[model samples]
Target: MPDITLLIVDDHPVVRDGLRGMFTSAPGFEVLAEAADGREAVALATGLRPDVILMDLRMPGGNGVEAITEIIARGLPSKILVLTTYDTDSDTIPAIEAGATGYLLKDAPRDELFTAVRAAAEGRTVLSPAIASRLVDRVRAPQGSTLSAREREVLRLVAKGTGNREIAAELFISQATVKTHLTHIYEKLGVNDRAAAVAAAYDRGILG
Candidate 1:
């Protein structure tokens, strides 16, 4: 088989250099180019059309999520693999939602990273163990107990001590709508009230 082609995107030069060197020395992989941020990554991807894009989330120019979304929108052939330091739901969920083929942490072993890249190039979903567990937990709730994104948003605000009226205003929904969301949250979390709902969310790792 031909070597898998890659575009490495990261804001830090040292990281870029290290990734380029690692892939260059590895078998069955080719570093097509290096990009400093999302914008450059998009531009390079457009021109090179590499087999895989190794992306970092936080950057000065543009973000990995934006790049992934745009690449998918433009229907680029390159598969995106997120290699970031952040594993939080806020970071991992959006990247996956934006069309990343895989999510891996920066601390991953070199062999694991290589395997993830290869899997991404083949259009397979690849997630690090931590990210995989989080996604599973997010969807593995009992029947009728999974929280929707909107419900999670409401619960997050409630965890911060935001009142129903305040959450309504912040979310641009009616207080009645906020109440409906809260009711669902309470049911899903198996709680009786706001305080208990918040506590349950945290305990379930849904809040964090």
Candidate 2:
């Protein structure tokens, strides 16, 4: 295997030290640099151009998601591998969407960590088994909506530029009932007006 240089990014000093120690003592790996948080990680990554970055998701400074976004946006060459303790939807989804090459928990075994890093360096997508299982479950499970069928109908009518009274007549309901449905639609979609509600619905694929 060829030499793969790395930048270790974590807010904790001990974690950084431990990662550096392990990678440096191993063959075919070079610990090129380390950063305390996301902001420092971005700066070092831009300058050092390491083969891979072992990034932490949460930190006191700019979090890992933002750094990963910025790095990918700037077309940086180094692949990012998220090495955080968080595996929830809020954490993993954004980091993966932000262009992280891999996601691995800090509790991952030492060999698994090495394997993930190597895979990340080769531009492969890696996720811990638990993380992968959660993602699969989320995909396979049904997404229950907070909006009712009638509310969705109202929103669809709103998207089609139908007036309240017209919608009421078409649905054979009173104008007051149509207005009430609109109010419920606005609340469920978290918007204030019909136009915003329509836009939100379309954005969430409820209108499309």
Best lDDT goes to which candidate? 1
Q: Against the hidden reference, what TM-scores do the models get?
A: 0.71, 0.70
Of candidate 1, the 10-residue stretch with the lowest lDDT total is 137-146
Error of 2 at 136 (Å): 1.0
> Which candidate has the top score in TM-score?
1
- Over 97-184, each residue of candidate 1 has an lDDT whose tens digit, in order, gives 9999999999999999988998998999999998999789877755224688999899889999999899999999999999988877
Q: What Cα-based lDDT does every candidate model obtain?
A: 0.90, 0.88
After superposing candidate 1 on the true structure, give the runs of residues whose Cα lies further than 4 Å from its correct spot: 142-208
User: Candidate 2, residue 90: CA error in Å?
Assistant: 0.5
What RMSD value applies to candidate 2?
A: 9.3
